[model samples]
Target: MKKARILMVVLFLLGICALLKCTTNTQPPAADGDEKTSRERGEFPDFGAMIPVAQFLKQYPGHKIFKLSQDYPKQLPGEDKIPAFFKMPFDDKSKWMDWLLAARDYCFEGMIDADFVAQDNKKRDWYHMPWLHYGPLASEGFSGLAKEAPISPYQLAPEQKHPGQVYALGFYNDFAGHTLYKMWNTSTDPDPFVTQGPKGGFPEGTVIFKFLYTELDSLDVPYLKNPYTRLAYITPTFKDSTNRIIKTMNLIQMDIMVKDKRADKYGTGWIFGNFCYNGNLNKGKTMKDRVANLVPVGIQFGNDPGYKTNWINPYPVVKTMINDTLKETFINASADLPPQHLGWGGRLDGPVDLNTASCMSCHATGEFPQIAALVPAQAFIGDTLANGSMKYLTQTDAPAWKKYYYNFKCGTAYDPKKATSTDFSLQVSLALEYYWQWKNTLMGGYYSHQYAGIQHMAIRGGIPFKQVKMIKKRGKKQKVDSLTQTQDGF
Candidate 1:
């Protein structure tokens, strides 16, 4: 039988190499009520079936408090300092030629003037615009607009023309297909840990699009393997009396990229990168004339993926799915029965405090002056409160501000079993065993999440209803209806 046809052709090539190693990387489906809220019930503490990775290695046996080192029990003040500005190599152009020549004289000839406003209407005019931010590889003492300017109301001085502030000085490109989306793709095998960028050499900060007539016309221009780029060189130029340059703008460019994983076309997500201007030198086309200024329209799907699928979108896994639904109702009641009594840091029968917004709701980040961004609030750290009051806490209100905000109701919405009189299912099994060991130390562990879409490209920049209010009444004049139908041929 020819040795049984060589053992059935070596078992059909090892079953096509175990179905091509189980169809390479794929994951993104935990968000729809996250596995029925990590189920666990009974024992008055269904704290989402516990499983804090074997009780977080029996309570941090080798404890590693969010990396700073020296093992840390408490160390701040430069905590063993190390920044000569992150040492070197991000593609060192001689150690970033003095910060890219101070980002080209602090973003050469910059001009930024925008006001997204309306947290509650600080004025009303929603989206006025003028943009540019630190270009010419800034460093010359953080580039012009004196009184110290590293961006922030554009640090005044050219006679300080504050006028409702908003003057961002030059350069921050990201425009390719805009942001980026593609989730998955396969050639048959290839993904050893994913790495590509040569044939057309595009991924260096991503940009390559050849759409023209579908199937990419003949299939080309499709690079991008993990490109994250940011460049800003501006000059919003301030002025007065007779000097000049007072907004004599005409040179702005902002290109932000992401769009690259294409699943056929128009699918994956994230996009925002497009702009070009250069003509004003002294006003012939103003409005900061960069080809008659008018760029706006790029930003996609911020909320509505239901589960997930991975294209690298970690905004801290949406605050770990809202602190695992408030640690599954603070461990249902704090388990351990028969001879129980365990109850460690209980008190949150459901008012909110799934570990006080899990790590200050994204660590909120420093500097506050009413935040717009000059420091304070950057990727993690939410619930504010150092006297800035957004209020979030577990205990301690003694000094000036003491974290407080745990209203865990978990079902209609604010649920997290709340945290207070201690014991609430052992503080939600020690806050999901300290957030599944801090989401297994982010990315490097491949849990994934990073490509921030040009900080909200723009569909009005991250809208979740800040104020629509139109309660009706006032003068009531019900029904009239008319203007219907339309053309068929001019």
Candidate 2:
């Protein structure tokens, strides 16, 4: 009887050990000669690769990509359902690409009302429409004119030190539409900045796409003749009163920011992708066909220390062209085509001077401008000249640059939860600034009439006039200043 009990006890212990092993063996089996499983290797399988191109075409047949010139019908047929589609598995790159193409088609089509597009060019303008307009800096509240020349202080082209040539920006509605409404509804909530939550605060399925253009022609600066240099100084020139010389503005870059819980490991549950115009087109094609010309530079999913930096260059052809260049090609913008001078690690950045700014690094700085006060002054201002005529701000070896880079990394001092988190949304940061400006206006008891005129027009569609009036009243006493500070390195 004693022997039997001992054997039974041993058997029970073995059973417990087996159960523990089963629970612990979560990782997939490693392949031959491989030390780690697929998950351990930091390579989440590309479920997107399994999807065929034909499948994508079948789903989004119209291929009616968004064009800046054309005024698309507001609230397109399938706009509301986009958020649902955006919820599809984030692990697959192919699926994400297809979703992006489709989302671009649907969201862009529906964001603007078609009737608005048909109205009088002067009275019913896309810019005047509330759903789509420039940011606060270019808005009237700052006394900014719609067609005013781009200012150097706000320009991102550090090398050229020239402002945007033909700057036009607009936001799209998605799952986070309600959030946009709530934040902008100043009459109800005057202090929206303090109300915003931490980094990765945006609800899932939120998608914000920003369209930035640079003029290809250099009629303004006749001395800047080189195509590369011309792109660097993207200053738009104008004609007479009767007819403005609409210079060809190339769709230089498009940036997409998405809120995905799958990216939670990165501190901010967000993914960023940037596209560049490759200058290639089908025979007899034009800039209106932005879909074809705009090629994906790459996508950044995370910036965490443990989360491997996975950059997906969807187009192999473009990658080949860029990779073939010498190492110096990346450090020097003039060596390659302006568009080809992508960010560090081949991430897509346009002709705007952002050689040192990665999508994650730039966007990670998405916090209230007030947070800037807490940050060291050296963090904002980069290093001085080393050899070139332009300041050597791009040098990665400098101590200041290193600190700047480290601070922008995921889960760093700059991105801490309490006072500095903007959830990786530049829009959120901008909104906070706007809120601050509004509050200050109230404190001073006066505001810019010109800025109010522009603000009234932009928010007219989304915000109530009563609320707008309240906001304007607050700004009545304060003088509106140019929005000199920029987030996302733009």
Error (Å) of candidate 2 at residue 313 is 17
lDDT of 1 at 308: 20
Model 2 lDDT, residue 178, Cα:
40
TM-score of each: 0.17, 0.49
lDDT of 2 by residue, 1-490 (tens): 9999999999999999998898779765645444332223332111111123575468546632222222222222344444654656544644555545554554345333341121223322232112122333332111111231232222222234333444434453434544443344232432334324543244565666765555633343221232211111111342221222223344455667776666665455666665554443331233233334445554566432232232222211122224322211122122222234344344434444233345565556555443432112122223323321122222234343343333243222243433444555554555455554555677875444223211211110012223323433444322222111211222
Clash count for candidate 2 is: 21
Candidate 1 lDDT by residue in tens digits, 284-378? 23332322221211112112113221121111111111112222111111111011110112211111111222211111111111011111111
How far is 339's C-alpha from truth in model 2 (Å)? 5.1
Off by over 4 Å in 2: 1-103, 106-136, 140-166, 186-195, 198-200, 218-248, 282-287, 304-339, 345-348, 373-420, 445-490
State model 2's lDDT.
Answer: 0.38
Full-model lDDT for every candidate: 0.19, 0.38
